[model samples]
Target: MTPIRIRIGRGGRGRLSARILVSQLAILALTGVIGFALFAFAQRSALDRTYEERAVAIAKTTAADPQIRRAMQDGGGAVVQAVAERIRQSSGASYVVVIDLHGVRHSHPMPQLVGSPVAEPIVARDGQPHVGTDQGATGRSANGRVPLYGPTGELVGEVSVGIPERDVLGELWHELLTFAVYAAIATALGAAAAFLLARRLKRTTFGLELEEIAGLLQDREAMLHGIREGVLAFAPDGRISVVNDEARRLIGLGTALGSTLDEVLPDGRLRRALDGTLTGTDISVLTDEHCLVVNRMPVTLHGRALGAVVTVRDRTELVGLLRELDSVRGLTDALRAQQHEFTNRMHTLAGLLDIGAYDDAYDLAVESAGAGQALTEFVRGRIGNPLMVGLVVAKTTVAAERGVWVELADDSALGADPPQLRLLLTIVGNLLDNAIDAAGDGPPPADGRTVRLALTEDERGTTVRVADTGPGIPPGARESIFEDGWSTRPDRGTARRGLGLALVHRLVSRHGGTITVSEGPGAVFTVRLPAPAVRPKNRFAEALPVGGDRR
Candidate 1:
């Protein structure tokens, strides 16, 4: 990465980064100010101590001087005053006062004040030395007062030495200049570090402003969940990077972020599609609930592979509706063919009548019309629901087209929620289609090629049993026969070849119904679906056809 420049001000490129830099610099400045104050305070104290030490040394040396001691014993004020003046001038002390044992000043800077009491308070009044800061003849100073004694060690007089407050402050200021220099260096270093940090942030942010980042976040969230399709993203290491709500619902996974794709998708095929080998094109993925057509795209930036994203379009409901349409279309074609055959028969019958063959025409008309009439009459009489009756009639035509014979074994009525009836249509319609395909092509109404559906209703529920003269489900596949994408016949090239049974199983389980399969000579599947709770106005239960066996 190349070095990036950043200006830290109100008009900077990144307001957020600039603000952070300003904050850091402010903190550093405050810290330096505090440190400088403390250093100055300590320097003042140290300078004061140096001044005090100088004062004490001068006082003690003056008191121990033989010449000054003898002069004090001899009461030679001139000699003592000369010695005090010499020490004060040489050591740059504020003042040097020599007081006799009677608390009278012997030597003072002012010659007229000799033989007078010391201007300052006596600190060695108990015949010992004392050191402290106080106001004296010369304004406030660090003073050291020493007791003077003769050769016999008898206290005679005292010598007081002091250094002025101005001298201490002057030295403190000199040391403070050094501290100020150090503080400036420290503040400069801190500002440099802050500037570098801000520059790094600018590069990482792609030089976008704070407002731009917020807008990007909002747009990403809207695109993730606003669309109907499921979206899943995976990092390069195979962990799930992002999963939208639709994806969770479609795959029935919760809180799948940061998990492996395999953990979210138990189906092996679906997991493999999310692998990094994705070539940025769409593929189909079959989960337990959805037949999702997935489009995978490799997520890259600047030609670097980051991960992959997958978009899932749910096709389960659309596929079911298409299957239903195929059944209805087959029924229409069958009805059209039947209509043509009847029309031809009518033309033949009309010719017969014209030729005076009256017996042949009458027989032909009854037989042709009666065939369709009997089938509808039988279906309507057995099933009290007009909707179920129509479905059965259509299913019969479709079964015939496939060369399989379909018949109802028992007359049953339905009393269920309207939504429940729609689900039952799916169940019955899919089962009939599968049975037709399984029975294969054969002459209708023949042995080893028939499909029988029995509908029975009682107080508890409706039971539908479908038995077909086809090969039975094997023992090994009985458990997984209802699972998605589990098809026995792979030759049928359909996108949702085995999804019909899976849909049946899903609807049945949702309604707390059960479906079982048994092997007789062929396959027999029985489904028991319960009726919805009855109300006072309920009218469909226990219904018998008025045209046949109604009371």
Candidate 2:
């Protein structure tokens, strides 16, 4: 797999990037607005000052001139026109008008105002600088108020000049436009840099996260594949996420991901087992044909549950071997019985021959020989597996003598794959022996204390139920029944050993079956086995070999 690379500036990271960028842009815009206002104010103030100074200079020059005084006194109304004309000829003057002290316009920028009474009077009758009164039509129409004074500083006719408002606003507007253009360029550049930086940071973080996840997945896969036990993991939604190879083979699934347990096993013990396990119930199931032990626990992080992981181990072959061992133990008991019987016969024959009753001794010897032949035939009829048949037959006789009934419920109907069948019988034998031991040496319990065996198979597959009527297993001990060294029988001793049920569990898994023991009128053990949907031509051999190493 190619490793993910951490590239910078591939995609944007967080909202803060845009937010901060916009905030800075807004600040820039606001600053630009404030600066524009200040610049406009300064330009307007300077223009007003220049216009006022020019007007003042022209008025003083005209007033101080003897020619302008002579002209106004002698030339009469023509004096104002001649002064206006000379002022208009001066620099930076657009329009000029002059009025006489008598409140009559003399020279108007518009020729029509030349003969009119000023229409706006500037000087009062006393002519004391008009004593702070507004004089109408004495000043220019466009610019603001202009107060006039004669050469002697007393109020005279007012003179005003009009300055175009556009000059000041035009300069301010030009400066504002330049600022706006610069701000826009700066904003664009800043935004682009922010986006690029955010994208780079985002990509780097995402790449790191992906690398970590990939490593975790690889580790999980190794753990699943390398472990001997089958492992299954699922999400809270009941979707199977991970199934080890061992688990796949055990549950007969080609693939587990994206599939639920219901989809994998359909409606079977494996599915049931998983359901129970996920719900925090640990279960052990055993029957005439199979034994399975399942444990489920929720995977959690910081006290929160992520999902559940189930560990399934098949104990079919293990159970079968344990039962086979029990059968051998039974045979030893039979041999011991036979030795005791033979010793008694030898004593009797010796006693009779010593008493000189030779004919009677001959008849006694024939009777002993006949009894041995019948015992051999009874054992041969009951034992199943060829390798261990002799041992089991002997054991059956021992169980019967102890008041425990050993019954076969048509094991051939189990329909387990041929190799699995062999393993099944062995597991059943152990369960039967355990039940027999629990029954003890007394009249059976009022409930008959009998061990019941039932095996049936059909299109849905095989089910074996071996329930015992002996005092039902203790509730607390039921789940632990298959655990190694969990025997309730103290009398069986180490000679019988506690490996029986543990081995039973091992064999159950070898054949991909489930074992569950429940409380009933007595103890009921149910085993369900689903035939491998894709049965290999050498299914049994492929799964496990006879007398092979078993763990």
Candidate 3:
């Protein structure tokens, strides 16, 4: 493969070639347009000159003829008609007429026009020919015109010569068709040549098997450069090999080539990754701080380890975020626990009252009730099991305090170690919150007002259902409610009310799930999630200290 003329510039090889090709096309198009325009102009000008010369010569001869002048003055219709007919036959004029200075018709190509007046003037020069062109008269065959006057410069009936526009128009049409054929052939040839050139250029310069494969490698390299992961390569001897920009930045080095793993990585997770790759197993090992996830794989050929590659991903910020999320989860659990205790204490007071311990029971009940928001307190306690139970309990307590009853029917078969529980809690919590808010600022839903929640898990996955007995979601508000900032309670305090459902939708989608709303006098939300066929190692448990139990 021969290297083409190499130019040094910011415009690299491929880009420079494209610029050259475009420049060529631009020149070709401009030349073609200018040349075609000039050709049409010249052709039309030549045709017009030839027609004018022929008309002028014929007019000059007819005007100077002696016999024609006497015949026009004394001969009336018979003589003038003969002259007009002779001119029509000889010159191929379509129509001719002769009239005196009074404009009365003396001779006519048609007999009816002999007595009529010549409405048009016999335009000509002194001692020259009247050769003004006009359209042919009456129902003549031709479309063009040429008029002549007599030797006395009197108004001899005009002789109009008509010619069809087809003669010049046909040539122009032919030329246009030819240009189109040329353009089509040029475009097809250019496209085919471009394809062939691109293939040849890629193979010669890049050593790539195919143009598409070269393009793929180019895209992959770009993606690797764009990412923030610190990627490094090893030559199976644990020596530092190829290091990308990100890896160099993380290691704080100018160049990483030819150095051992110990020199480059030092006492960090990068050293552990090099050690892991030497074992020849594809594995992702997390660092002590749980901040980095490193994947090591051996690049081999014929069962021989040619080299190994390690992709270092910084998960420091991600770990911090997960810790924050866990704190939120803890708060949810505490809330559920409080709800359970409240419910038990309330049951004890009711039992005492039923036994007829009037004064004692009444006093005990009033003390226990204590004007505090017990329902709210209780709902916050039961945060485990079928995930929706905790959310439903919280929702019910909130509604009851606000004078609305919430009935929850959940069919979550989630064991204590269900993977989907956390996701379930997020979804149900959002839907119930929306339903409670939609119940309005009024006295909840009249008498039977309630928020209903149900969760069902099956072979497919999990499905959550939440509905409110309030005025139901408005037809128009139903669709927009899931939009990020859409809120039915626009006046509700500084705390955001709308982001809950939007976040719920995003989380569900991230898990490869779908959520939909059912229309009604009240809003109903349903969510479905596809269960992972294979369980993942519990990273939360793994994060615990050596002997610590997350359970």
Candidate 4:
């Protein structure tokens, strides 16, 4: 045999963890790049300011020096250049220049530019210092200017100091390298977090992809509602988790999800069966309008208890058919008994004729015919329904064959057909059958082996009582006698036992009736079915009568 293979569809995208890591890293990288650019711009601006402040401080010191002021007063020449260059070398500035009031440079970084006219006007002639970035002869630098003074505080010229832009850039690069290392670490940590998050999600989803989960959900719903059997899934806490359409129809629970069993079901055998208090397979539970066979199995995954699933199948129609079959079997037994009686009479007649006793043979035949006719007429006169009368006659005949007397009680009176004849028949038939079996078992009763049936009809409803002269029911078993699958009889293996009383109970309860069992010298079962508020059409009225003759 070839092995069956099942396949599940997965998403076309890559694994969840890898995708998360890549996406997170991309986002982190983008954010880091933007951050680094902003940091570099801000750092460069701040470095320029710092260099400009340092240059202003250096120019102020040089302009305040007595020697530089004295030399400028003496008409700036080599002495002034020497003092400026010394300050430049010590302060690490790019250039220092002293120019006279006529906009002529007295000192410059290039020796040839000394004693040459400056390009700009005397900006520091007011004796205030000025600092800013300027493109000088050497390169772009942060420059500062202060007015130089001669002896007696007389303004002679101005001193200018500059710091190169390259120095500021060099410091910024070092800081940026350190910041890049931090950004890399941050990106790595974000990637690790993304991978861990993806792993957690994978475990939560049971390793199924999004597409596979959606597919399984669709399949679950289709199968759940499509099947004929009712399905109910309960959570571990005993609340209804999933209830299909069939389950709602079967149990009369409309939109009962999230409700506990006790909230929906009454305290009865049906509740017991569903709640698992009555534990068994294919347990029969009778409701007000339906007979159900329910099976429950606990669901577990990987040694953990999930809950239970209950499946229900409607057996109402099947049970009715089975009862009808029992009725036919009873009639067949009656016919066989009648045939045996006829054969005995035939043999007797032949013997009488062989001895030439024609008169005795004729009398024997008349007596047998009168006896059968009298029983039929009595049943027909007592019970107005032809169907019920036929059942009584057949059961009496069958009982006689087993040496058990079956009779209608003297007080039995049903002048008109009951409104619910079919239900009445089922109730009476099952009770009489059970009584017959009970009365026939063991030794004959002191009052004789007999099953007695009493029926009464009135405006209120119909009542039936069946009593048997057999071993009385024990007190302990009385309550369970009418329960499904509980039988006192020895297992016969030929047919299923213990359903007759259960079906009877269900029928009685369906019509808002009650049944009780009591014991005196033997067991007595009494059932009362109240009249319906509005009588329904009798569908079985047109059907052929049960227990018809086959021979």
Candidate number of the best lDDT? 4
Candidate 3 residues 1-551, lDDT tens each?
11122222332446534644565566666766686787778766665455545555554444445655666655454766777677756875445454455566655567776777665654431333333334445442322223334556565544334333454466557776787688767766765676567656643444333354578778867876888887777776877777788766654657668888667566533465555633333222333333345566667543456567777776545544453454354456546765786788778778877897778878877866763445434333332353344446545655565556676453434444555556666566657656665663435444566777766666678777877766665676665665444455553322323446655666677778988887767667788888867655762332221110010
Ten contiguous residues with the weakest lDDT in model 4: 542-551
Per-candidate RMSD vs. true structure?
8.4, 16.0, 25.2, 7.5
For candidate 1, the 10 contiguous residues with the lowest summed lDDT are: 542-551
Q: lDDT per prediction?
A: 0.73, 0.58, 0.56, 0.80
Let me know the TM-score candidate 4 reaches against the reference structure. Answer: 0.68
Model 2: per-residue Cα lDDT over 1-551, one tens digit each: 11123233434345444555566667666776687678667766766566555555655455555555554554345666777777766644455555556766656567777867755545433432221112234433223234445445555555545444445466657766886687678767866776676557544354234445488689998888999787887777889888899877666678679888777676544576675532434354433334556777667543445567788787777654654464555567767876887899899899999999999999998887887476555444433334334323443566666666655553434321333555555565566666666665335776554555565666755676766656667767766666544566552321324556665666677667888877644677777767666655543343322221111
Candidate 1 Cα errors over 4 Å, as ranges: 1-34, 42-104, 107-200, 218-296, 303-328, 380-386, 410-422, 438-449, 457-461, 467-499, 516-524, 530-551
Candidate order by lDDT, highest to lowest? 4, 1, 2, 3
Q: Write the per-residue lDDT of candidate 4 for residues 463-535, one digit (tens) a residue.
A: 8998888776876777787777677765433234677777777667766899999954578888988988977
Q: Which stretches of candidate 4 lie over 4 Å from their true place?
A: 1-193, 200-206, 209-211, 239-241, 256-259, 489-496, 519-521, 537-551
Q: Identify the superior model by lDDT, candidate 1 or candidate 4.
A: 4
TM-score of each candidate structure, all chains considered together: 0.65, 0.42, 0.33, 0.68
Local accuracy of candidate 1 as per-residue lDDT tens digits, 452-539: 8887777777788877787667776665777655676652322346667766776677767999887434678889988767532533
RMSD of 4: 7.5
